[model samples]
Target: MTLAETLQTKLGEWKPAGDGRHSWAETFADSGWAVRIEADRTDTLGCQVWEVALDRVGQADASLTLSAWADRIAASVTGLPEKLKVVEIDQHQSAALLRSDTPGSRGNDVLYFEVRLAGLAKASIRRFKSEHAIGARREQIPFIITHEGLAKVVGDIAG
Candidate 1:
């Protein structure tokens, strides 16, 4: 079976958000976080993205929320002896991950770039939009990833 076929099989039960054969996306949301996986373009770009937002961090800095999650994903994905400095001198986790060649890194690491801020406030809420070339006045799609079932497929390839 193809990679997409394997993904579709693994995530057969996941809800869809309207992706076609060329794309796949999935989202997991809770009071504490929102996770989005968009990997349909991975095959061509050799990159897969996993996005997590800080939603209920009572006292955790939002960028730290990204840093913490990125650290977890990096450790899990790389099986490091200890978590490396995800936020490099550039002070950006996404940049570090993109440039890293950690073991088991098939260029499929979750990025933490959207939070390049110096810090995230405890009372502030920040969200980055996923835009797909809107016209002058078209209603923007909700935060949902437009692709439907491709996340599972991409996971098969990336996993």
Candidate 2:
């Protein structure tokens, strides 16, 4: 099966978290396994948030590691918008770190940026919004891809 088709099929078996804050999805390919297309909304430090995670399995001797996939994914996502400036890039044994500056958050007050994951066949993306705090209005913004989305993107690249 194609990668996208496999992903769609895997997504169907997901189970929701009891708190209504998270869900898990899974998929299997001829060689690899993908898991946890988690989606959720919540509040953090008075800020609205959302998140998603996608992970891959079976990497005993794969040619493309998660970290390499993350690098390609980062390049793809960052290329989406010029305003999304990459702030930091780091990598560990099996993971990659990406920090970026987003557009203004909360009615042009504070801006939003996130540190997303982009290594490992299984990846995730999380988002964050920060208000300027100087007469700025509070906004119920979506979750920033802090780590979850990065994981998925990396997986996509590797696949």
- Candidate number with greatest TM-score: 2
Q: Per-residue lDDT for 21 in model 2? A: 56
Off by over 4 Å in 1: 1-11, 15-31, 41-73, 78-99, 102-159
Q: What does each candidate score in C-alpha RMSD?
A: 12.6, 7.3
Q: For every model shown, what is its TM-score relative to the native structure? A: 0.28, 0.53
Cand. 2 Cα-lDDT: 0.46
Q: Write candidate 2's Cα lDDT for 1-159 as tens digits.
A: 555445444444443445655654555555365655445532221212354455556663557654555455556654222234344445554445554544554564554544354555445555544566565564433543423333334345445
Lowest summed lDDT window (length 10), candidate 1: 121-130
- lDDT digits (tens) for residues 1-159 of candidate 1: 543343344344444344432233332222222233433223321322343222222344434554454454444433211233344423353232322232122143222122222233211111123223333232211122212233322222122
Report lDDT (CA) for all predictions.
0.30, 0.46
